[model samples]
Target: MVAEEKTEGQAAPELAAETAGRRMVVLEDFKPVAFLDDDDRASAVRRYSTLFVVDGRTRKGGLGRVLYAENAWGDRLAVKVLTAEEGADLTEEEQQALASRREAAFRREYESSRLLTGIAGFPTLFGQGRIDGQPALIMEWVEGQTLEEARRRLSVDDDGRLSPLVAAAIGRDLFDLLSRMELVDGGLVHRDISPSNVMIRTQRASVEEQAAQGKFDLVLVDFGSTVLPARASSLTVRYGAPQGATPDYAAPEMLTADVARVADMRKSPAVDVYAAASVVYLLLCGRPPFQLGGSSTGGEGAEVASDYLRKTTELPLPVRAAHGESADVTVALDREGEAVAAVRKALADERLSPSNQDLKEALVCVDKRVGEVVLAALEPDQRHRPSAAEMREGLAGFVEAYPANVVAALQGEPLFQDWSFDERRKAGGFEARRRAGARLARWAAVVVALGLGCAAAALCSGVRVTAVGSLPCSLEWGFPLVAALALAPAAAGYLVRWRGGRKRSGLVRGSVALAVVAVAVEAFVLSATVDPAAMKGLLGAAPLACSSAAWCGMVLEYSMSAPSAWATAKRPAQGVSGKGGSV
Candidate 1:
């Protein structure tokens, strides 16, 4: 028989009884209800199953918070439970594998969450008892503002922006504390650092919360996804992107499953950086960075909306747009747009980063420690990424090294030779200029920061189109210095570049030059204007240094990319008579 849901005017139905170990199990089932508290004119109805669900929409765990809860003790205490049954019903082997997995997960939750002890406000482990019919574990109930809530309470301003200083401080406290758990005694990565797991309460009752047996002060709850022995090396495969990373927080690696397959998931920390950037974006912008404003959970809805807005909107990075002035104005529109786009790209995709200029600008407004913590995890190449152990050591150095001095030295560990440095420079003719430019770029950054005010604000004010072909040459020096210094071995690369390939005619050189000039100008203007000052700063006063240095290296990267020029141009030439009397 089809069961009917309860009506707004009806009382909650009592549950049917079933036998347990000794006691009885009852399930009243979830039903529909109407809210009476609303104004007389507001008519609203929702489904609620007495099977123990608390708040419906807000309570769901998609964002890492308690999603749906069952009230065991007259509804005062709520518990979130997920069972293997919820997944696709498995065959014998699948079921056994699933059972084994859940068992290990339950045990890990009990052990790690139990150890949170005095550090980091965490949920209290209540009791673990087998239900009469089903298996369930009980934990202390959490109440008050989630980080999202704090954002909302403080979000009265229509814009929903938090000061960079305030956002950074909050970010620092949370990360510095979280870093302490990188290895968590032996080896464990929180694996999931999205904002929903973080909670900041208005009332901090340390003693009371302890007395109540729940760690409720600025607590980070919901460790259901924490990595442990039985846990998969990557929670990202299942809980990432739409399910967890959410469009705004989802890293490029976490986005497409295809790219994910080719890349090193376990080694790439960009996944986490993407999440961290989203959090920073939300804290600073009020609205989550990439996700569109609304109840769009992680899904195509959020992805589509975020993309639309990102392409059209002027939302600046919290580091730049928060105060409205740190950014500059005279930079030109094309440049400003490019800069913003770069900042957006950094937050969305790790591969798009390595922007020193953008880094400097972001650091200026962002919390010094927050910047440090974020960088400690960002590297496009998996090999260059810091490990949890490395992160621990780096963090130790960070806290002890007078926070003021961290930025100048905080680059990801130098790229390995296998990464091939020199092959990147010879492509562009800016080899020597690239080196000179790197220093000046850093110097110009200080000047811009000190003398010009916020380059971001300058971007917001108006658009300034840069001249094509020839650049100021002074603005883009920083990138090449590192690439050149790093690739001194390839100093004679240009002389040897055409060594093997068909000799280049003036037309090919002109074509390549024109193409390079067009790309450089566009890249620079875009990079300088919209990308956060921090990101822009990294590019320095030059154009694509590393790529320019290693001509072969650059081509290799391009080779794997979509359709190439050589392939298209050479396709038609293949028809040119193979023999003397051919066609």
Candidate 2:
């Protein structure tokens, strides 16, 4: 029998007698829940026979235990349960406060998941229920390694860092996801957006197929610390605020004690924006922006957290105080002081700042625009950081400006070089400029060669000695031979360079035609007033000289420009596949 739906006023169903005291319950007859789809509801019913815990006692932020389990049908799931046992040892008041906070956080997560249903890159929610008096949430199993793991595997160097292009791509996807989430619910804030919470799933299909499916390879997970601005005010006032963000990834505002009172802290998309930029920074540099003095791992967790919090809140001090002209200085500073001053100066300089320097060195192979966008997003002040939409647009612009082949190479795709030469053209990128410069130089050389040929021909043929009236020497066949010698090389060079090309053939034909017209004009004038033999020789020699010079111009142009074209054409073949593994 299909289970009846519960009204808003009704309480959640209680466990059966046999499952009453157990932390994990296997319902005897699963009922259809409003939150779950028909297929999942049916699957839950058929597979509700048993729930075996595969991993034991996985805890996050000290709030609850995450139990990894598989149902009877072998479908894996993650069940988060907030138990009262955590505060069992505490006094009445402390226990009550803790319980209230946990309940509020659990409810906030459940509601956010329900509202975020059908959103791509978000885990699907099955249902919510009570398990042994504790609130339990069952979420669909997302199969993939966390971005943290992916980052480790994709690290390019000894320092474990991501390439600039890869980092930008990941950042773009993350911001796009945040933008969509904000649009869906204006008040939604993903309080925790760290590397461990982002899943990087690899798809079997090609990139085009994945785009067609409207699915992204990156997925955001673990919304346990999500907050809704409208509901957070009441929840915080009643249960005290929930502090569950990763210290290294938390925004400065979030770390402050007055976070509860700060209106911007509660609902600002800037919170997620800050954390997302931190994630990208971590990927690009292999460490958080503010690295603790000591080790990040081991028993120094509290120390590392404290150090990170302090750095984010305060500006670092310089090595030495500013010098005063009137101050009595008998004691000179030591070598350490000088070194400190240098360090301070370097830090103050934008070009030499640790983050900028790191990005500059690491992204030498990437476009400069991409590095600028990433660094802008990493600005400590939230006001200075780009909005999620703006960040996405900046990265998208980089992708659009470059060719698909270049992008594919940056992404570490294998078939990148197999693309056609035309596909490698980038509108505003290096290759485009090179092509433009080459064309201009080629044309300039042709013009210069043609002009020189015309001048030489006119002088050698002795066509005229006067400025106005035509004057001619005795008819001579030697002038024709001289013209042929000067023009033939140019014509031959043009033919060789532009062989099998229509444009080359057109240029050659045009030059020959122009030469013929000049000869005919000269012959008409000279024949009317001078020797017909000399006019004929001048005509034949002038055309030959011009044609030869045009061909030589083609040779000069080719010599000057062909190297760059060959270099650009050969770049695609040295694909970036060997740099990083397949995308």
Candidate topping TM-score: 2
User: Candidate 2 on 421-476: residue-level lDDT in tens?
Assistant: 22222322464455466566556656655565556555655543232245444434
TM-scores for all candidates?
Answer: 0.41, 0.51
Please estimate how well model 1 matches the true structure, expressed as its whole-model Cα lDDT.
Answer: 0.40
Q: Which parts of model 2 have CA positions greater than 4 angstroms off?
A: 1-50, 56-62, 83-90, 202-216, 234-242, 259-261, 292-368, 399-583
- Please write out the lDDT profile of model 1 over residues 38-129, one tens digit for every residue: 44212222222223433433364432233334433343333444455333544677666655555555555555665664455566553333
Lowest summed lDDT across 10 adjacent residues in model 2 is found at 318-327
lDDT (C-alpha, whole model) for all candidates: 0.40, 0.53
